[model samples]
Target: MARIKDVAAQAGVSVATVSRVLNDNPSVTEETRNRVHDAMAALNYRPNAVARSLRTEATRTLGLIIGDILNPFFSELARAVEDEAREAGYTVIMGNADERPDQQDHYVRTLMEQRVDGLLICPTAEVTPLVEEVSLGERPLVFLDRTLSGVEVPSVRADGSTAIAELVAHLRGLGHRRIAFVSGPSTLSTGRERTEAFLRAAAEHGLEVPEEYVRVGDFRAGSGRRITAELLDLAEPPQAIFLGDNLMTLGALDEVRERGLDIPGDVALASFDDVPWFNHINPRITAISQPTAELGRRAVRLILDALHGRPTDSVVLPATLVVRESCGETGPGKEDGS
Candidate 1:
């Protein structure tokens, strides 16, 4: 392999100049940059990431810990983060925590051991302390999706309450007095926030949100299907169900199909995070679309900013309600902008 010294000799420049050119340092003249590029092309030279990391004390790599890689929301977010990181000349290492504390802890430790330059984490409640310690360390850390309470790490998230409020209001507008809230495990921040928001919004709108009408699942499609089945078997079945996340939404759809229940006709549906298949499905799903791309891009920017010695802070991106056939045209809530 062509080494830096070889490139330097080929380009008739010092090793320092080669380094500057490779790093795209603004101080280097365009003519010098061209010469270095020409030499690199001629020699087929490739920078050694391991060597560069040793010299700079930075791996130029980021660790991404997601709640569930199977979920389209997380998958899309991961893709976005990876794309943005690549554009910024950084590599990404991903881990799926599956929303389990012990698993999450394991991944965090494993990533740290890899000596990643920074982290973009969607923390499980069990790994709160793990995140805190990492944030206090030298590594730049940014929280994505769910964040720990009282721990002031820079984060990017969707406004859960506002999205829930909109979902509830939309249902109410559709003449749904008894709306059920199907949620995931309550231990995570996202689940808790959505549950709290659902209850609060229903109460504010003079709707009775009975405990029996609320069901907590594992945020999986199967969980959604099982919980929806249980809800349907209840003494008082809900007219509509507001799902907390996309995976659960899929489960609910399967349940409806399996049980021969018609969406919007038998039970109206609205969910958070518009997954890619929403539009293509038989009965298109109505959803609060979190800015998935923006979330990933912002997380990358925040991590890079912190690495560059810039101040890091939390950022909550807005959500939008996408009207579709599942909720019908006159769906319950009035979207904030709509």
Candidate 2:
């Protein structure tokens, strides 16, 4: 097999310059890059990835830990991250934590062992000791969607406060006074933030939310279905229901269908993390539309920036309300620009 020395000799350049070309380092002039490429092609030389990674102390790989793989939002976000990472010349290793803190820790340890260049995590409710340790370490870390307070890591997530408020106002305009929210685990930042936003929005409109009206779920479809069933069973059921995420929205829809209740008739429905399928489904769901793909792109950029010794800052994208028939889009709430 042709070696680096042979390519270097053939290209009439030093081995170090050949190595720079192999690494695609821009410092190598265009003429030198072309010469190195031609030499490699003529000699049929293929650089050793393992040796390069060992020498450089960089794997050109990123670890991504998502909350749940089954959730459409997470799945889509993973796809976007992968696409952007590939374009940036890095491979991505994804871990499905399934919203379990223990599982998340397992991936963290495993990825660190693999020596990934950086990590992008959508954290669970509880931060494990391992997680805390890694955050304090020198590795570049970026939070995806969910964040932990005082962690000091940069994050890429959406601000849904305005969208949640608009949703509540839309419900109120449709005459939905007794509304309910099916939320995710309280341990995660998203669950807590969404709940707080909902409460604040409700209070602003003089709507009283009983303690029972707030139900916490596992951010999965099953939890959504279970919570929806329970909510519908109340003696005085909520006139409208707002689910925290798309997977929960699916479960809520399943429960609604099983009970033969019509959306916007028996119980109006709205959800956060609008997925593509939401628009295709019958009656169409009302949702808080986030820049899901952009969130993924930004997460990769932030982590890469950190890896490159560049300054990094947290990015918060905006979430907007998309009015649809599921929430009975009455004209009163239209003024909020939903």
Candidate 3:
């Protein structure tokens, strides 16, 4: 499909010029407008949701940009947001950033051009300038799951420090001394925060977490598998390996299965995000459960409240540790998976 850039090229103008024309901006010369229209006709270009809400001063539509559609956590969060928006009689347009900062910026700009009543984003760590602009702009903007320090936007995020501490304590009690971690990329706030929380918890428990014990993954199954393999190859491998995200846990499990390693019996496993499937896995995986659906619901409420001239504040929800057999709790009559 042809994009805005193609229209700009055919019209011999910048993409911004095409956007202005589409929005019917009064600043554009009549000649330029004619050229843009001619280009559109020649190329059969179709404009996306553009400026329909300008006159009414409201689109009754909310834009939601997510980090990754493939992540089950984000998927559940999106569903909650959509449900809340639907109940409020507002439509939601979703954009998947796929964890790319540039892609995120693109969606933000496009949604603005579409004149969405508000925006909800699970921002990347890069902190694109456009996001800052939206926060400062007249429109209502809210950050979902992640927010930057200086952005000044209301956010709904989950705190997992307590859960991480509890998980560390559980592992220590299970007689697991050396525990390694597979973390997500540093380009996201969740990735950094979870790892920091784990480190703090490890230190509090008197367990040393060296640089080698921390491997960075891209929050994908492939990275989880590769990092787990690298960690397991160490001369003195860790007694347990904790995955920083749900998808990473899937990858780690694949590696363990291919190598014929038993859960908890070989190397104990844990995860940051708890999904439904985790419970079904043999020797159910121990995990930290985040308020994902609540985050989404709270984010929508914040945006709606702001748009309605009501007060709004950033919401921080808690995560809890869910212990299962994957980490192998030791007790009488237990199979000793730990």
Residue-level lDDT for 238 in candidate 1: 90
Q: List the residue pairs that clash in candidate 2.
A: none
Candidate 3 deviant stretches above 4 angstroms: 1-56, 330-338
Candidate 1 regions off by >4 Å? 1-56, 330-338
TM-score of each: 0.79, 0.80, 0.82
> What digit string (tens of lDDT, one per residue) describes model 3 on residues 1-338?
67666889999998668867876778999999999999999999876543323323798999999999999999999999999999999999999999898999898878888888999999887866556545655567898988776667788999998999988999999999999988887767888898899899899999998789998998899999999999889999999999999999999999999999988889999999999998787988888999999999899999999999999988999998888889786444423233
Poorest lDDT segment (10 consecutive residues) of candidate 3: 47-56
| Candidate 1 residue lDDT tens string, 1-338 | 77676888999998768877765678899999999999999999876433233223688899999988888889999999999999999999999988787887777777777778888889887644445445555567788988787666789988867867877787787788989988767877888888888899999999997888988977788888888898888888999888888889988998988989899888888887787688787678888899999999999999999899988888898888777768756443532222
Model 2 misplaced regions, further than 4 Å: 1-56, 330-338
TM-score: model 3 vs. ground truth = 0.82
Task: Sort by TM-score, best first.
Answer: 3, 2, 1
Per-residue lDDT tens digits of candidate 2, residues 90-189? 9999999977889998888788778898889999878665565466455678999989875668889999999999888888877899999998878879
